[model samples]
Target chain A: MADGLDIDHIARLARLRLTPEERALYEGQLTQVLGHFRQLAEADLSKTSAPFRITVSDVSLRQDIPGETLGSEAVLRNAPASRDGQISVPRVVDDEA
Target chain B: MSESLHTLSATELSRRLATGSVTSRALVESLLARAKTHTVLGAFNSLDADDVLRQADAADRRRAEGKSLGPLDGIPVGIKDNIAVREQPLTCSSKMLAGFISPYDSTVAEKLKAAGAILYGRLNMDEFAMGSSTETSATGPARNPWDKDRTPGGSSGGSAASVASGLVPLALGSDTGGSIRQPASHCGLVGLKPTYGMVSRYGLVAFASSLDQIGPFARNVDDCELLFQALAAPDARDMTCFTAAERKPVHLPQNRKPRLGVPRALLEGVDAGVRAAFDAALEFYRAAGCELIDVALPTAGLAVPTYYVVATAEASSNLGRYDGVRYGHRAQGALNPVDMMERSRSEGFGAEVKRRILLGTFVLSAGYADAYYGKALLARTRIRDEYLKALQQVDALVTPTVPSTAFRLGEKAADPLKMYLEDLFTIPANLAGLPALSFPVGMANNLPVGIHLVGAPQAESVLFALARQFEGSHALANRIAP
Candidate 1:
């Protein structure tokens, strides 16, 4: 009772890798959950809220003036893997590079 | 002291403070003591006994100086842990942010503080406000104070339970789908989910940002209105806050006219006992000269599907910021950065949360976005139009809030389908972004049942006026169970 999407696809979408047993278990659970959503399909969904985004202003330029510097160590402390006082880790897809 | 403390409604407490029969300090002391006694209910997240006492002392000082702040001055209110209160660890009952302290207060929290209302502690809720039962909480499911074995309905479960058990007079809760009304119906209290943007979302921890709305919980309808007036405003911080909605004045209606819409389609799934109680309430309203007519909202049937798709999609994106990078619990010994993101997220979020995120990611993926998210948006439009059409016919729609009253805690938790069906009656209001109130009509099987009274957006004054008149005519919902 699986859809076109299998366990591996579902896990990949979630950024999770699962064991064989877990894959089997989750596949069944996913099917059941989808079945439950059918009841919602019965609803008449006509009123949609506007797209949700953080209410922040968009001006990328920073003022080129003497501004108070933030403690670099405090900022880097939250980074998972920083090296030489800079954030360092996996390289995202950089087609040009 | 414990029994008396648990029963003081916001209205009664306000009256006592005004008459000098009691000071705010005494009321806060009794509340603080009773909260400790009812710890088994899982009604609170983080509370500083000292801080609450200090706030109460200030309220008394203000009263003595003849500086009454507002109608809710000196009355206590609990912050749903999801709503930020600076200096408190605003854990939304999740391991993700176990000890993360909010740097600033939410607009609602700021409003309550400014109004001279007593700051009660944070109450428990569903993790990310995703589940129908608060059982998904990392802290544990909030207990029904009436029957400890049963769950107090969720997301706002603790807020509802705390008031029902007399631990507090009123508390704040956020409803996306049935988060507020479901729990209120389950626990037999007054819960209101104002129209979208009715209350500001400035500092409420994001959970389906588009659908998430902060609302109030109380023992009666008037108390709910009192908390609503205090918390709602056109905050400059929240862009969604309405500029037109007013903090409804305490309106003692000079006119006897009130109209209620009774939608039979919505009432089809209501339990026999609940329907019996609801029917009795309608008769009472009719006898009192309030108009009750059957109205139609054909598209309301699709609300749950639309809500799940829209809410989950927003939740997946909103929660993406938590990558063990900034706030919340992080993996102690990750071999690499990618490993930390995976382990920290998997360990921090609950099963239900992870499940929703996975579903959301799939729906928003390259191939399925148009079918899932796009179609859900269309359905939402239909639901909104149906509500607008029906509102032209009557003032408000009346129905049973849930299929039945509060059931045993684990009875539906194990079956996800059973749990979601509990929201069937309450999701439409959220989908349409309309104001809906759940008031304790009477009781069924000794458990309280709530009748949903829905109104057009910014039409709270109409709702409040009708509720007061309904209270004046009905059985008084006089049973005080603790």
Candidate 2:
């Protein structure tokens, strides 16, 4: 069960900045939700394997030939900020570094 | 004639279109008018009357040239906002994608257009398909047509509500857990969640990749099958989709009474109305010669917990791409990229979506990964195996679609745990990647009660046949919202 502090860490990892109210609310809710999730421990999974993978027998792959693709103009249409037919974002790296 | 056109099933409408009794344009216009009057249902997020009429005119022209596509040709179908229809809004009913227009058609949308169906409306949904009730949508909750004050079950609530209220005869919905089936039950429509990978997920906003499946909601099993048939095909775009040779034939065979397995334990806590309706359906199947056997799913109790862990883990990873960068909503001011992402998501996402992302991030976190996410994967394997084993003994497993009828808006909104439990009966099918169908069995207190059927992978035909047979005999068939 995640506490208020734990939720802060989780929110950071998820790239979400939660309001104090949301943090308090989610803390209580997630704790209770996790308590419900504890029932999963009761399952007898000794014979089972972890990291379940769906194995489709026949996965047909298309040829390596390039096909028609969305133009940069169309692709950038939905971007909130764009410049020169490309999506623009706040600089990630420290320019001085 | 136009007044009643909105109520006709796609099958009946197709027959009428074949004989030139109706033009697609006229039928679309009639439905559009009905949709405007019934806007109180909150079923659609965005609809363009002119665009819908244009497609309808194209279908009409095709018929005039004797180049009709098929039964789906000329049918108006509502699309869940999560599924991309090129040049149309694909918001997923979240503020994150408020003005985001899809640059490409999803495989389902492509197929629908190729089949000559007029794609209409961006149906509302739980924000990012996170909630069990449509109340979480940014567009506001989609109210149940049966009871205006009540919610249509979600995250495909709008899909169910639209079809139920006769805004459109057919609609598309994505099921991750019970999103499609639960709403279909609440709205008294037939919804199917096909075996995972049976329908291509390309262009579908990914919630939980392994669990998510795009399926159809229709007035009847036949119409549901018609839409499913149109959508189910090999797509190179989604590698998980069945290959051309791997795709199983969907034809319902001759009338063969199926051996149905009932997990009596799972039905214990269901509402009395739902239990009674389920038992009555079972009794009808038995009297009609179906062999009903008692089945045990010991791990079934673990489905809800296991689903939350697994679905959230995948969702957290899948949603990482929405980091205020290329597309979707971007925050106004931020000193850095990371700050921008955090602020944008925090501002754009609703409470439910934020909660899920937090839960998912926690489960997949370093120290907790083994305890929650890893444990869930093992439990999921067991649950899947249990379902597969049960299906070996019986052609299908029958249960109630949801524990109860359409819940009033905000009834379970404050309690996340209670809302998650709504998918208890339907989650096993998704975990096991099996085809499942939900069809209205009866009504209780003026709300619809639906029965659920889970079949083996690629066993959609069996589910359809059984559901169609029951729907044919039931008086509740073809019922519409008052």
Q: What is the TM-score of each candidate's chain B when compared with the real chain B?
A: 0.95, 0.98
Considering chain A alone, what is the TM-score of candidate 2?
Answer: 0.81
Which regions of candidate 1 fall more than 4 Å away from where they truly are?
Answer: A16-25, A38-97, B1-3, B244-257, B475-479
Best by DockQ: 2
Q: Identify the runs in model 2 with alpha carbons over 4 angstroms from their true place.
A: A1-5, A93-95, B250-256
Worst 10-residue lDDT window for candidate 1 chain B reads B244-253
Query: For all the models shown, what interface RMSD does each have?
Result: 5.8, 1.6
Candidate 1 TM-score on chain B: 0.95
Give per-residue CA lDDT, model 2, range B1-482, as digits (tens). 99999889899999999999999998999999998899999999999999999999999999999999999999999999999999999999999999999999999999999999999999999999999889999989999999999999999999999999889999999999999999999999999999997999999999999999999999998999999999999999888999878877544445656799999988878999888888899999999988899999998889999999999989989988888888888899789988899999988888988888888999988888877888899988889989999988888899999999988898899999999999999998999899999999999888999999999889999899899889879777667799
Residue B68 displacement (Å), model 2: 0.7
| CA shift of B30, model 1, Å | 1.0
Model 1, docking class? acceptable
For residues B371-469, write the lDDT of model 1, one tens digit per residue. Answer: 677777777777777787887767778888888888887788656656777887788787777888887777788787887877877677667667666
State the lDDT at B119 in candidate 1: 71
Worst 10 residues of 1 chain A by lDDT: A52-61
Q: Judge candidate 2 at residue B453 and give its lDDT.
A: 93
Model 2 residue-pair collision total: 0
